[model samples]
Target chain A: MGDAGKMNTTHRRLILLLLALLCALTSGCRRDQDAGKVRIKFWTFPLWTGITGNEKDGTTEDWPRLKIKEFEKTHPNIKIDLEVVTWQGGMQKLDLSALSGTYPDICYLATANLPKYASQGILEPIDADMTPEEVADIYPNVLDCCKYQGKTYVWPWLCNALVLAINVDLFKERHIEYLIPKPPERGWTYDQFTEACKALTFDRGDGHGKVYGYALYGIPLSVEYQMLTLVLGFGGQVYNKEGTQFTLNSPESIRGFQFLMDLLDKYKVVPPGPAGMQGGQVGQMFANQEVAIESSTSGVLKQLKMSAAKGDFPYFNAAIVQPPHLPGYKPASMLSVGGYAIFKQTDARKRRAAIEFARFLTNEENCRALTVIGQFPARKSVGNIYPGDVDMGVVSRLIPISRVYFTAGAAELNPVINNIYQSIFTHAMTPAEALADAEKKANKILAQDALEKGLDAKGGKQ
Target chain B: MTGQDSTLKRIIKSRWAYFFVAPAMIHFLVFSVYPILSTVYLSFVRFNLQGNTWVGAQNYQVALSDSIFWKSLANTALYTMVVVPVGVGIALFLSSLIFPLKPSRQNFFKGAFYLPQVVSAVVISMIWLWMFDSAHGLLNYLLSTLHLAPISWLGESRTALPSLMFMAVAGGGGSAIILYLAAMGGIPDSLYEAAQIDGANRWIEFWKITLPLLKPTTLYLVVMGTIGSFQVFTSIYMMTRGGPNFATNTIVYRIYQTAFEFLKLGRASAMALILALIIIGISAIQFKWLGTEVEY
Candidate 1:
């Protein structure tokens, strides 16, 4: 070949290589800017996966993955990247992402976290995104959990209500099944509940007890919901109706705190050193038939059923009963609600897509389908999805009256209240002293938060 | 002008060397330097999702007055004091005991002690948590077999910190033992033989010849162990979560909770900077005291 011909051939090859390199570098950017397609990131904890069935159990796909698939099928113009953040460190990860401006477009928010995020302006309001009919389908109590300062921030998805669970096999073995109200209509009053616990408790005067009547979960950091339910059942409220004051030191609240202390210290119907046990430990104790009664969320029902199916719980079967109330007070259950909240995004189309995806995930059919994984749907229209299941039915019925433990500055209030309960349970402080100390500290935190946010003493944003 | 030209020419001559190190330099600059500077800056400001506002030294002032911060600091100090000396002592003892053994026996002992070092702190904490369970734990079960009453290891405030210390002192000190063994191997046999010719006892030999020779290794382990113990978070996070009325709360755990849980980034940064200073001070003091010139 001629020298000019060889030079031209080399030049052509170099140009082609440069072009390929450019394309490789810009391919991701090009896909991101593709016309008519909106990409949204949805981050959620593993609340649904591996709960019920997988390849091993021969059930359908994971619910969150399935919901994403279905949503994409209908909304072909949108793509969602589902990131399952493990529940253990999920909150810290989300908080760091939020601070770094790399937060997902849509994220899950719990009742305790909703107000904190909303107050920080990290979440966008979704009031205008929902249709009236869609809004009406959700029960008011559940829907209120997603609201802060008269603005909706999340699409209510599923809720878990706290209830009293009993070891039915143990009760029968002890012939104390009669103590449990029959026909599911009559509920246990304070006196009846206390008497039954005393009868069921058997201590052989040794260091160990073969069976304790109740497993009181006293892990301070995570026991707020359970302990608050007891306080509510005793006709006391942690906060006033306006959520502006810390009323934990009220006479009724003190009485409730005293009642718990009496249960642990005076009566000794509960296991020793209950302060050391978390929810999972208490569940394990119940499964092992060491504790006859446990106050837990509805999710425990599914856990118990799974254990029974696996033959791990062969010694006893579990049943759910209404949480007992004080003599003159009505029964109450503390509700834990999980839902989706959209982050603040500058792109209009992406925000719309995120909201629509959230709505689709929480829609009636999808919410009902999620029940297979053991979460009660937030929408009231599809009630009692677990038909013929007596325990779940009772939990479903109580959903209407359940109250959330969300209060302003709950992120700061929780530790303080938890410390008070820990003190009471550990016998470090009297109930009155603990209640007073908690009220003082919590009020100080509330005032500081209010001052920082320019809110009034009455908790109104200025 | 000529000197500047030569300097530029020298840079151009070694450009490939600079190019080779550019990636590492950039990574260190972006990750390490930037975070350190950012944390220092954030310590004087109140940061939230919205933005940051200057709060001056208020965060430090608040931390100084806060009882919880002091309590956590005290807990961390106590943990470091207990874990460092005991861990180093145990490692020294074990390494000495295994030094004269046959190769196979030495390997067996070393591997048995070093096996736990490979396990993650989270997993070890979980195993300890199960062992410390109040009612049905293996520790309590063993206690019951001996006709001893069960102790609430992690439940009561008096025992919670001690339980964590026990876990640290038991499963930890593995790497230190290996390091000590390596250092002991480097010691000259002539010194030991000379001491033996003088009829020096084994205990005197260990105290005089062996212990003095391992000074550098002990100093290194002491500094590292002190730093590690001061930053103890994973065990507390997985096991106690600073519970039972802040008995097991350490400085790192409290800082994490303040930053992420309460969103008090400014306060958390201040606490972190204070902890860093304290660690540096402690390390400096340790070097001054135990860091002797061993030129054998």
Candidate 2:
């Protein structure tokens, strides 16, 4: 008892000493918030620059240099330490930095991953800055994904809507008549698509050269846009009327996966083993003249147009088509956005400086300039610039007819859907097999969130 | 003895030695001992971004059942099993190969083999990841030339573990090779000469003489290799991310992801404690296996 008493006294002293030390350290950092030049650290992944976009000498994308100059001019004293990260390790890097509570002033993340971060209180709500007019000025479909629980943490920027790029020269040589029936003015059926691709396909005989019907790059979610767009075209729904309940195992989503798989295994119209190539590889194949029709994001459109503007590359006849459709189908395509958010830093000046720099970078002018690279405007007045004078014939005709799948504040849904789609396409899991696996996994993620935070953690339908 | 004069002198002499050691001892306790003890304390608690609390046994419990923990453990076991003996074995073989060479040639070859060890593990792992990329990677390119179907070295689940192991062996080349050469250099040239004089061939001299002398160095390498391999983390984080379904997930990676990503601090701590225990246990086995029957 006497020894125990002595131990307790020693422990108490140790605890008090440690508390004093921590207080001294934390207060030292937090208190420095009051004074000092605002040092706003910005972290970002390179926006879709092909391997060549080195900002060092302006050989490729000069975005970093251009944006950095403008940002520094606006916030003269705020030292913006810009750190470039890679996509493969981006999320984990952000999470690790955030957990330290010493993250950069601003960082970019996919809009898909935002809700999870925001709900964790790692993201600062942008609700205060966004007036009703600002909300109206932004793409309603894009902005709808940024809000969570009537508050918003992120403002969407640099949107990438997928499109279909065709090798028009191949169509002309094959004597195949290709038509992009403009949406509302014209509608597309699945039969029309297959027939066009079939006519374009030519087998040059064994070991000589082979041209398959259509250059559909499969190899998994490389075809997600085509799948979702076709599903909406077929008037199929991914989720229920209320977004809370998942209906991935429903007939519509299953049919969507089935139709996608059929293009590869059944029709033999897609390239041999559409499941073997990734999205970018497929795009490169189209550029190299290995594929005829490429389903790719608009981010690549600028480059494709750039090459076209240069001269007979991928053949001069190449142009874009609006998202393809299925017969009796409504329009739907995957919606995605990549952008940055200023974290709530312990240093108030640094935080404000970072916020200011982020504002300078994402302003109307930068957004307009970014459009030349196929980054859609996040602001009201900046009109679309297609990197060319001519229109890619009849793009996203079903834009009005298509549905948006965003629970901006609720991120759990989209990734789960993506995971399902990837599994089916890559592992060759049947639509039923993939849907069953995804539904269970998706529900568990939601349940785990609900259990940890509270039932209301998933306020999707609510 | 002049006892009356001697007492203060003795005290002063002893105090001087302590004064000399005090700075280093203080540095050790502050930087080394304290952080380790703190981690142990953390393992008993629920650690998080802001603060942690003592939740004894809970973290341990979560680690006990985690599938990722077992996968990581299995990967470590496989790595330690492969790297320890093979690392020591090749070190021994290379030493024997160089032992009879001209002094100039011996040094050049030793330096060449040890070169890879001098390079950082992170840089080496990055190169390996590229070499292992499923498509458009160098490995695939080489395979294409051979008219073989491309093997997804890093991308495929089955090959990820083996790919990292190969890199580990290659990078692990440096330290063990040098240690074996030093051991070989010390084996009095007289012993080999004497054995050869007795009509023993080169192979006999190696197996009967050089190999036995290397026992101590071999033991040392075995213990160190086992300990190091059991704690592998950075490779998976850089390359496989324990994926294609938990193939390359090592214990350390699982612990880190668990604590940091999942935010299950208690669970993560538990996993770490288990890893620590496993490392200790494996070290014990290594000692038993490699322990020499020396007079000392």
Candidate 3:
């Protein structure tokens, strides 16, 4: 009786063990099946990823992460990995990744960099993937920024227009409050702007007054677009109508360049040592109330307001106004557009997932969410999220007339212009001489770029 | 036949050792050797994300003709010339001063100096950037307190490279100091006692004994420092971006710009090769000068 009972118990134990192993094997196979899901990698800058305000308030879920979660919920077979890259050295990192064949499936491309990536054929044409309604939703002007050879390569997201940020307290202290444009569309002419700068600069005759009228950023590469804002405001266009030539030495551009030099050299309204300062330093000077006015983009409004709220400024009532225009020229601002583009992907399913994810990130609802973080939505339907926000309202009014600082050879042309501007700041060349030199160098670069891309002399794509 | 069989048996017995080293050897081959060989090949070709084409010495010709390349090389040479000797001298002086301290005091000074080495170069550059700001920087603030007009420490071309040099000399000698102190510690106390008996003073003993005895350490530090300073990219990138009319541009920084920003990988590779040769040549010269045999 004991032997029979023992045998039966041993057999039952073996059977149970076999069943457990079978279950484990089946679960492992299921895990492998889940791993087969299509995964897309997205790289973006910190601007699109909003600040993580108090974790307890649940503001930590930034728009990109939130959209990814919703996307995964609907498309159960797809997964997305988001990588946030800093603006500093971001382009270098992307270039290395592209060369090494390790680039993400999707990446954020600045409007100025779009041509470089597009011309190199590193970006896939997204026009076929975008629906007509989706294409129609984006502002026409912004959509134009994403096109190269009539093919859309990017899904345009949000944009920021360069504007004049004024310290109201300084204006009041200087008794130049009337110089602030009322409607902003009828901005102050160049003469009035110069007068305001002179009045705002306080020397105090004892080396004690540290305030300056303007915070000029002459650091190369980063501040070129800000410099271009002043150039465009004076009726100067960077490239001609066909985008074939650089007009940096034109009469209008020379006037603009001379005026900037005068602000630093002749009038001394801008702070000295601007050649070493970057965009952040200018923003900091404005925030610290050390400068009366600064030329900045719409993105700085949130920071100025935050600084005011934090009591970091002595008197921090900031106002936005359209950039000054010349007497006979129309008012204009430098429009900078940043958005997402799909990298060249060989897998059809993965490419579709990447494009879908990019669309989801820039759709109307998501863009509206992005607006709360101080980005101007690219869709006309969204409009101004904060109509009451004076700074944003001014930005909205300026967007219609603002001109983008992009050309076929923008990436190559930027450094040359920056070098010329720096030379002027260093007193190495007069504005006319610098502009003339820049025109020569820019044309050389454009010619080389055209030759490299197998384009004709007229700058048409091969 | 018996000897060969025993060697084969020994190798088989020690197979685990080879197995353990395989990962590291494979890593060195893949990351180091492959990249070096690829860079050599890329130096003679035009490369892009899509593909590469043979350009055959065209990049080298461009680099030789490029004025910016020569300026960057000169900047690098100047940086190395200034940073190596000054940094090494300061490290030696500090190490001599700290050598006589008690163990606890020595550790305290060592830790204080070595702290900068532990910090990232990017962070150091950023802190110095604020400190060198023209209007609000601490340096300018100090100048103002002394009734001196503020000098644009990093704005003007005259002071931009020097400001970077000052930063390099300040905290960059941490590792060198530690190395010198360690080398000094290894010196026998009997030599100092012998010199004292010979009526030699501290300065004479330092010159006749300490300086000569520390030649090997000095040589090592000089070679390493020259190599490090020759590739000064981070500080330039973070602080100046080789700006003020390329006043602070260095070989490595220019190579970085050419490769990444301009997407001229071929030219960047050529520049990198030139830099490596310069570093090697300078190192060989340092070895020839300071590498005399010192008998303990």
Candidate 4:
């Protein structure tokens, strides 16, 4: 052969060798690295940040790292790979991971989303692993949300309930201190709440413009749990008992929506353009004392406590209250619970290790951290985490009356429900018309979900 | 030789050149082409992450019947209509203004305008969110100074979509300006001098020489701006989230909601295909209307 032919043969061989090496390097690298140890991938949001509303803290990783270190200390043969995801895009990441069949063995699942994942058969039921005593200890209502069909899908960890946070300073300034519900007496009629809002809202010549009385995030496409709290308090439910139909057009629901519109238009208490207001925006108004009362969650109570402890403000005085109810109904709160769910695993040893770590992560010792964040524990035995704190005490007492605002296909209905608020606030649709339109849109979503589930349009078996 | 044989021979003769382009071609095939093909396939199936069931044309039917889908399409069209023309106009105006300045001054203005392009869209959206705040926003503050009522820039349905368009027209002209400036610099000054010798005023000269010459750039900017506006998601996701009754919900945002939030990958894929077709149709029209052969 010529010299050129020889060099060409060598080049072909070299290229073939390089392609093989690249393939070997890219495939199954993780398994080769961890030869002896059982590796369990655990995905989580920054849940226990030692303070409420501290999920966004740059140091959120510290608490999770400490816990992972403690878990590894006890189980030397098992290694836990911790991945912390952000709240904004974490669920979508989880969905994409599941679709790719590369999801973590353990992850924190929002309770509202548990049914959807469980129905997809991606979640491993924790019922077989959980002890009967442990099962009994968890609050029944919170535990119910973690279950799909009849099996427990998630290990309930921590829960946050929607509550009313009032700026006591503003109430005092309006000379409506008597209207503020005391800690033990957390009840008020809708009429009384409106009267108080009227008294508190006024144009103060302080150059900061008019200080409003109340605000609840009315933006479309948000969770709308704060608004749902009012609906529940007025004896309305977004979904029927079986979660099979849209019942927002019920007379009671329209009344609830009308009350909010009255607050915005008639009473002139809520800030203008509620359709744009978000939770952060409303929270900012409450903090600035521009608004006297706002719908919030127990997380804010924890945030206030942290601010007070750190002396972040001179006087950070706030109280937790319940949403006012109609004359015959009871005050209600909307609750959102988050917990850990184990993904389906074929490796028995890795699955057991993940379960053990999940248990350790939510044990009584670690659950004490929930108190610092002004959150309620899933277990009743973790009783009275807040012994004497008035705000948290009120929150704890309201758990029984707390309602879950989600069902299967709740994500699809978010924009539909948000439209009702937007239309009502913008006066594009009256309360009745908006509620009816929302019901129509919501039914279409439910019908699509039903079709996917092989059921009839009304959500019954085909 | 046959065409295929000649092509193979040509590739073999220029083997080094082919090797140099291999990585980029492979990247384009794997990342872009593969996903697009997969999306087209998924659009014809019932994909639930667990399994895929073939159901041809069902997802497309559902998308066609969905009212929100039509509303979002209209919103996207409206956004593209306003943003593309105004954005290209602003870029051309700014480039014309900056072209005659000293090189140092021109560079300063170019860098200042291009700063937003370098910054993250999410960060820019957050800044705009605060600036549009009803109570404490700079816009409202300015209105209050003039003794006018503070407008709810994002909260009211009437103003929400317009607010987004304004944000795009204001900040989106940066990159287009750089493109325009480069295109403008490439145009020979001899054309302008000829027009001036023919007793053409500056305005007439600009109308006759500068505009016709910049047709290629203008066409590019319009088509690209339309595509970008149709896919407006980050700002909507960050600032308004298609709020105030979904007055600002665009096609891409709706697709995201359907795919990620609703977990209906198949339906999302169908909607995406519909969007792709619409873009293709509109771009074809733009090309046929505005396309021209410019001579140096």
Ranked by DockQ, top first: 3, 4, 1, 2
lDDT of 2 at A138: 72
| lDDT tens readout by residue for model 4, B1-296 | 69999999998999999899999999999999999999999998777555677768989999889988998999999999999998899899999999999999999999999989999999999999999998889999999889999998998888999999999998988889899889889999898888888999989977888889889999998998888888999998988888788898888999999887777888999999999999999999999988999998
- The candidates' interface RMSDs, in order, read 4.7, 8.5, 4.9, 4.8
lDDT of 1 by residue, B1-296 (tens): 99999999999999999999999999999999999998898898766667676778977987777677898999999999998999899999999899899989999999999999999888998888899998878998999899999887877888889889989999997899899999999999999899999999999989999999999999999999999999999988887778777788899998988888878888899999999999999999999999989976
Tell me the tens digit of each residue's lDDT in model 1 across A1-462.
999999999999999999999998699677766556899999987765443454465422265677788898899899888888877788879888988889999988886688767877889999898899888988888888888877899898898778888888777777887888554533577677777778778854565457878867656444367756666677777787667788878787787778777778878888778667666787777877778888887677677777788798674577778778876666878777888999998999999999999988787787776666667899878777888877777778788888866878888777678777677777778888988888887887777776666622223221
**Which candidate number would show the highest DockQ if scored against the true structure?**
3
lDDT tens digits, residues B73-122, model 2? 88879878887777777777777788779989988988898887777768
Query: In candidate 3 chain B, what residue range of length 10 has the lowest lDDT sum?
Result: B46-55
> Better model by lDDT, 2 or 3?
3
Residue pairs clashing in model 1 are none
Candidate 1, residue A126: Cα displacement in angstroms equals 1.8
Error of 1 at A364 (Å): 2.8
Model 3 chain A scores worst on lDDT over the 10 consecutive residues at A453-462
Each prediction's DockQ? 0.31, 0.05, 0.36, 0.31
| lDDT (10s digit) by residue, model 3, range B200-227 | 9999999998999999999999998889
Q: How big an interface RMSD has model 3?
A: 4.9
**Regions of model 4 farther than 4 Å from truth:** A1-37, A49-77, A308-313, A455-462, B1-11
Which CAPRI quality tier does the interface of model 4 achieve?
acceptable
Name the Cα RMSD for model 4: 6.6
> Judged by lDDT against the true structure, how good is candidate 1?
0.82
In candidate 2 chain A, where is summed lDDT lowest over 10 consecutive residues? A392-401
lDDT for B129 (candidate 4): 91
**Which candidate gets the maximum TM-score versus the true structure?**
4
